[model samples]
Target: MLFKESFSMAFTALLANKMRSLLTMLGIIIGVGAVIAMVSVGMGVKSDVVNSISSLGSNMLIVSPGSTNRGGVRGAAGSRTNLKYDDAKAIKEKIKNIDFVSPSVSRSYQIVYGNQNWNSSVMGVTPEYMSIRSLEVSTGSFVSESDNNKRNRVAVIGSTVATNLFGTTNPVGQNIRVNNQPFKVIGVLESKGQSSMGQDQDDVVIVPLTTAMERLMAMDYVSSVNIQVSDANKMDQVQEDIEVLLRQRHKIIGGKEDDFNVRNMTSLMETMSQTTTMLTILLGSIAGISLVVGGIGIMNIMMVSVTERTREIGIRKALGATFQNIMMQFLIESVVIGVIGGIIGIGMGCGLSMLVGKFGNFTTVITPLPVLVSFSFSVGIGLFFGIYPARKAAKLDPIEALRYE
Candidate 1:
């Protein structure tokens, strides 16, 4: 028989049992839909994280105190107050690639303005902090070098703090008490929603580092230093330079670890991206199990089909149909079932992903790669499972088959 005739025979047979064919495809439909939805959600989360971190600044690096060993007990990173203001000053003056350096120290304090009182984080920083953090003042000005030098008691409040304390009133030029000590509000920062860690960025107040260390916390060490490099490509080199410089300043020799840690945003980006990619592959693999089950369903139904058409097979063989032609007919039927399932599965998967994004507050992106992969895999499953049934049908004895009831 010609290939076209075999295809026609297969099409007619499937059309006669439409219900069974659809039932066999159910597993494939569900598998494809689940895989697409889950992978899309993972990618969306990764994109959100990257965007949030990028919004903070460009080519940023963070330096914080490293762990301290107290007798054999080691503390967590930043547990030791080893990072100081002078370290930030030295990096700013000596580093050629660095654009700005902002030394910072933070503590929670009760802020009182008029009759309103709110407990919020108070940050001590320099004027360069505003640019390094991508923060802008809506009114008045940020802390200047003179403010840090004079140890002036001035505050810059975030939008959330401004709303909570001053309501609709212009907060700049107003006096707010920090830890019962009065400080004039010099600026109000623009609204920043939240960090990737889900912490509110607009729920704090800023002051000069000198004021925070000497007046508010009574501490001499800075909590961290935020650095912005001039070029993103040179961040790793700059980070190494900063590490060597800090290690020398701290007098660490040989293989001993330094007292401070340097973190570049590029490394963080790569780590986060890798994590999400792993999650996507994991989800897709789990969903693939259903495709195998669907293939088994096709095989089971094809076996039954061969049994039911035993007399037909006998008649065709007795009429001079070759073994190859009989095998081709059955194989065509199975592959048709798979191809139809794949097309429908693609449609269902895209629709399901969109629905999830709309109602589940998830981000979903349906790219062509997943669709192509799933469709090709489904067709392969059909061929793999169909071989046994097709061979069995072609091997039937014509004499016994014709005598069947």
Candidate 2:
């Protein structure tokens, strides 16, 4: 028989038992829908993480104090005071591919302006911190080199601090008390909202590095140093160079762990991306299990179909229908069920993903690749599951099948 004739006959048989065909396709529908929705959610979360990391800055590196080991136990990372202002200054001067550098110290303090007060992180940094951290002033200006050199008590406040302390008032040119030490607010930084870790990025106050170290915190060592690389390709080399320079400056010898750690933000971003990609794959794989179950359901239904149509198979064989014709007919019926179910599932998944994004407060992304994959996989499942039953129907003996009750 012609392939068209086989397909037409298969379609007609399914229509004869419309309810049963619909029921048989239900598993595939649910399976495909689940896979699509799960994958979209994973993609959305990955996108959010990438955006959060990108917002920090481009081609950036951070140098922080490493742990100190006294007697056999080591302190937590960044607990030591090994990094100093001169170390940062030397890095800016000696390191190649360095765009900007900022040595910083931080402490939490209660900031009071008029009758309002808020607790926020106060960081001591040079003017170069602005460019290195991609911070912009919405009013006034950032700290200057002269400000740090003179140990001026000036500050640049973040949006959250501004709101909590000043409330709808522009914080520039105002005076605020940091730990009860009055400092003039020279600028209000643009809002950065939140980081990937959900910390409020805008709840900060910036001051001159000298003022913070000498006046506010009364400390000698910097907590960390920020570096901005001029080129993306130079990040790794620069990180290594910074490690070498810092080791020399700190007088650390070979075969010993350094007192400072150099962190490449690009590397951090890559690590985060890899983690998110793995999670996406894991979720997709879990959701894919349903598809296999659906395929099994298809096989069971096809087997039942063959058993019910045994007499019909015998009659067709008696009427000159070849084995290939019988096999193709049954296979076409199963494939048609899969194709129709897959199309419906795709629509259902898209709608579900949209709903989740709208009401679930989550970012959902639906790319074309997942949809195509799910559809193709569904079709393959149908063909695979239908093969066994189709073969059995084709191999039936006409004489015995016709004589059986």
Candidate 3:
């Protein structure tokens, strides 16, 4: 028979059982929908993580005192007080591919701005902290080199702090207490929204490291230092150099391990991406199982269809129809069922993906690749499931088929 005749016969057979075809399509529909929805959700999370980390800066590297341990039994090489102001200055002068450096001595204090009092974090950092952290000063000037040199008790407040304290009044050139020590207001930072850790980036205050260490915090040790590299390609070399220099500076001999650590934002991004990719693959595979089950349902229905048409087959063969025609006709019927179901599933998947994008509070974009992939896979499933039943019908004897009730 001609290919057109085969296809028409197959389509006609499927049309004879519209209800069964529709029910078989339902499984494929749900499977495809789940695949798109789950993958879109994973992609949304990954995009959020990448943008949030990138906001910290492109070539930003964090150097902390505890990082020297390299994830030993101590865990995470957490920051220690071994870092000092002189170490920060030395890193500034010594490291190659160096851009800007900020040594931070962080403290939490109960801040009183008029009648509104709140406990807030305060950081002792140099003016360079602004450039290293990509922080911007909105209302006033950032604390300058002269401010640090003179050990001036000047501070910069976040916008949240500004709203809480002075209302609409100009906070600059005013006095606020840091640990109840009077400090002149030098600058106010623009709102940074939040950090990757979900902490409010704008809920803190800033002051010259000198003033913080000497006056209010009253500590001799630095908690950690943030380092910005001039070249992204040179990060490894620079990290190695910083480790060697700090190790030597801290008076630790080689082979015994260093007392400090260096970190870059790239590693954090890699970790997040790896996790998301795995989740996407896992969800896709689980959704794929439903497609297999749907294919099995198609096969079961096709077998029953063959059995029901036994007398029809006997009459066709008695009329001199070849076994090849019989095989082709039933095979076409199975493919018809699969192809129609695939189209419906693709539509359902795309529609569901859009619904998720709209109401799920995440950006779930439907690309053409996944749609095509899913549809083609469904059609393949149809062919695979149709094979056994089509062969069984073709192998039936004309005598036995004619005798069927």
Q: Count clashing residue pairs per candidate.
A: 0, 0, 3
- Cα lDDT of model 3 by residue, 1-405, tens digit: 788988988777777778887897777777766776677666766777777887777787777776443664664322356878888889889887898988888888877766677678998888888887788889889989999889998889998888888889889988887778887887889998766456677888898888888888778988788888998888888888888888888888958776776887777788998997787778777887888898899889989988999988888888888888888888888777778878877777778778887887666756666667777778888888989998988888889999998
Candidate 1 vs candidate 2, lDDT winner: 2
Which regions of candidate 1 are displaced past 4 Å? 1-12, 68-79, 112-117, 136-154, 162-177, 181-192, 316-328, 351-363, 395-401
Write model 1 residue lDDT over 150-216, tens digit each, in one string: 9999999999999999999999999999999999998998888877577788999999999999998
lDDT of 2 by residue, 1-405 (tens): 998998899889889989888888888898889889988998988888887877767898988887334357677644578788899989999999998999999989999988889999999999988887788899999999999999999999999999888888888889999999999999999998877567798999999999999999988999999899999998889999998898899898978888777888899889988998898888878888888888888899889989998999999999999999999999998899899999998999999999999999778899999999999999999999999999999999999889866
Q: Please identify model 3 stretches exceeding 4 Å from their true place.
A: 1-19, 67-79, 137-141, 151-178, 181-196, 313-369, 397-399
Give the Cα error of residue 233 in candidate 2, in Å: 2.4
Highest lDDT against the true fold, candidate = 2
Question: Judged by lDDT against the true structure, how good is candidate 2?
Answer: 0.89
